[model samples]
Target: MPAPHLLLVEDEPRMAAFLLAGLEEEGYRVRWVDRGLPALEAVGREPFDAVLLDVRLPDLDGVEVCRRLRLHHPALPILMLTALDAVEDRVRGLRSGADDYLPKPFAFEELLARVEALLRRARTAPALSELTDEPLRLDLTARTCTVGGRPLDLTPREFDLLAYFLARPGQVLSRDEIHRDVWGHDFDRGTNLIDVYVGYVRRKLQEAGCPDRLQTVRGLGYRYVPVSASLHDDTA
Candidate 1:
């Protein structure tokens, strides 16, 4: 595919120029707009993988812009940028259809990270249906996870890991495989990150009073044993 296109909507010219230059250096194709109305017009004219929208504009409110985009362009990832840092303001932005939030005076690195994560999340939204075990559904679109009729509170990474495992249920996935599959291939392997995250998953399951569905494959890897199979085998 072509380099991801970003619609950058910030009223300040210098800030918009900085973002455009930085993101272009990172190989993203950016189209910068200085107002909400033109941003909406540009978005309506074509497709973009993600949008960085300023929450305040000279003639239009950013929340309403987000709402309009969401009504018609629901799948497009929208990251809201604002000087407002109040919890209520953040909540309002999210409730108004922003997929991610970034406050002013933010690090450029953090903004890039949020943009990448939002795009990643958007990419996975459509393929989520085929990435889970039956009856234990994970709707990435709805941002809900359910296991055997019980809902689970999972952090984003945990949810991704679980969904990945369920998609390949009964298969022994190595630490490297797990990391490459869920965390991305660029993830550093030197750290014991997979082990730590697995431990987190186990603790969450145990705390939820599960029947111990996750199993260590005797120093090799991990597997998600089905609840029924656990009962009959007794040794898993």
Candidate 2:
């Protein structure tokens, strides 16, 4: 297979240099751009496998660049890099059509893992089937999720999280297990990344008028209790 082509858009010289060297070392074809316009132009000229976009750019907001890229290349995998780790910031990136979000000051291992997962999903998307937990259904192929037959708008990460839960009904999943399985990363004790995403999915499910399928098991992790059947939330 050919090397994955990646476009890196960052304004900071040192950061760009660091990422450029690391990505190159990992045997990826990376194109560096200092501004948003150039990044867009570059993508138009070449077929890139993925894009590493910074949220703050000199010429344009990285989120807007992502939105534009999504409009033209809906299937293109985009990972947004930013210093902000707020829930809204992450949601904004995903809403702009980013396949993944990695905050700045992250380990290169995590970035590489995210990029790989996005690429893997892209390559295997056509072979995926819809996952369902009764009223909640996730069309993995279309990347669309619905609850109770009503379409629910989900961020890429949120959809993946819910799909993971639906795929393993009644199984108590630890935080570390969820992180490793869902996003190809080990659980970080210092970060609440897993919790934040779980909260998002739970809230969305509730908003869709679904039951409290996700239950906190005191000292243990969580489990998906399907509503269609009499699945007990027996996690402890």
Candidate 3:
């Protein structure tokens, strides 16, 4: 397959250079845009497998950019980068239609993993056709998801996280395993990255009326089982 094309929109020159170098090293073809307007124009002109958007921009805010992009192309996956880590900031990011949110000062390794996982999950079939205990339905080709006949407006990270569970339904996966598979092998397991993103997914699922599907296994890890399935099926 051709290398995945990534649209990186960051106002900070240093940050943009840093991310471009890292993504290029990972073999991704990247197109850099310094402001929101150019980013919007670029997205409208070409096809990108995924987008890395910064929240604070000179011309437009990241949330508005995400909203505009989603309006033009609903299926395009967007991951927002910002220094804002507060609950309300995160909420705003998702509400604006960003698929995932990454606070500033993130690890390059984690960034690569996130991009890869999003692309990986983007390659699955639609979730509606399958009614199994697995609550995920990925049509990677078309980049769409439908959980229990209801569509999930998943950011790239949520989609990748859901796809990871579907790939190993009913199996217990440690946080380390999830990070290795979803984030990348070089990611630091010490950070609360997994937990934070999982929380994001839960909130979105709840919005979709399928919050119960993604279960917290406490000390073990997390798993996804269809909410419509038997309550006794705790294996997921």
Candidate 4:
């Protein structure tokens, strides 16, 4: 496989140079952009495997850029870089559509590890095929989902989560498994990110007039029951 293409969006000259050199040395194809608008344009013009976005940008806030990027490429993995380490700041980044959050002053190795993890997950994800469960259909190649023949506007993470569950219909997945498979990270029992994303998927599925096929297994993580299957005891 070719080296993963990465987009580096950081305004600080010194920091950008450091990241660009380090990432290139690590065998990644790196494109460095200093401002938000240029970064947006670059992504629109080319395909990138992942993005390292700094929160402080010259033209637009990184979070805003992240949101816009999500609209354009809902499946692209985005790792947010920020000087602020507060929980709220991290939450803001994730809420804005970033797939992962890394505070600044972080070690280069950690950043590379995160990027590699994202790439691994992206590569290993189920092949691009139309996955269907009767009324619910997920077009993996197009990255579009429809429920009852009506499209659902799902966020990137939401789409991934739903796809993950739909791929393994009727299997009871643990939170740890879901975290590792969907988020490409070890599960942190303390964090509620998985549950939040699951809820997001559930809400969209509900809004699309699909049955709450996302069944909660009490202590177990969750399961997806195909609409064709019997739902005698499945809990939404």
The local distance difference test score of model 3 is 0.77
Poorest lDDT segment (10 consecutive residues) of candidate 2: 227-236
lDDT for each residue of candidate 3 in 26-142, tens digit (9 for 90 to 100): 899999999998998998788998999999998877877886676445567889999989999999899767878889889988888788777777677332322234354566544
TM-score of 4: 0.57
- Compared with the true structure, all predictions reach lDDT values of 0.80, 0.82, 0.77, 0.84
lDDT of 4 by residue, 7-54 (tens): 999999999999999989889999999999899899988889999999
**Which of the numbered candidates is closest to the native, going by highest lDDT?**
4
| CA RMSD of each candidate after superposition | 14.5, 11.2, 12.6, 9.1
Off by over 4 Å in 1: 127-236
**lDDT sort, best first:** 4, 2, 1, 3
What candidate 2 gets wrong by more than 4 Å, as runs, is 127-236
Q: TM-scores across all candidates?
A: 0.54, 0.54, 0.54, 0.57
How many Å off is the CA of 138 in candidate 4?
A: 10
Q: Write the per-residue lDDT of candidate 1 for residues 28-137, one digit (tens) a residue.
A: 99999988889989988887999999999886678878866764455789999999999999998997779999999899999999999998998878633333454566
lDDT comparing candidate 2 with the true structure: 0.82
- Strongest candidate by TM-score: 4
Collision pairs in model 3: 99-155, 113-183, 122-140, 123-140, 124-138, 124-139, 124-140, 125-138, 125-139, 127-137
Runs of candidate 3 exceeding 4 Å displacement: 125-236
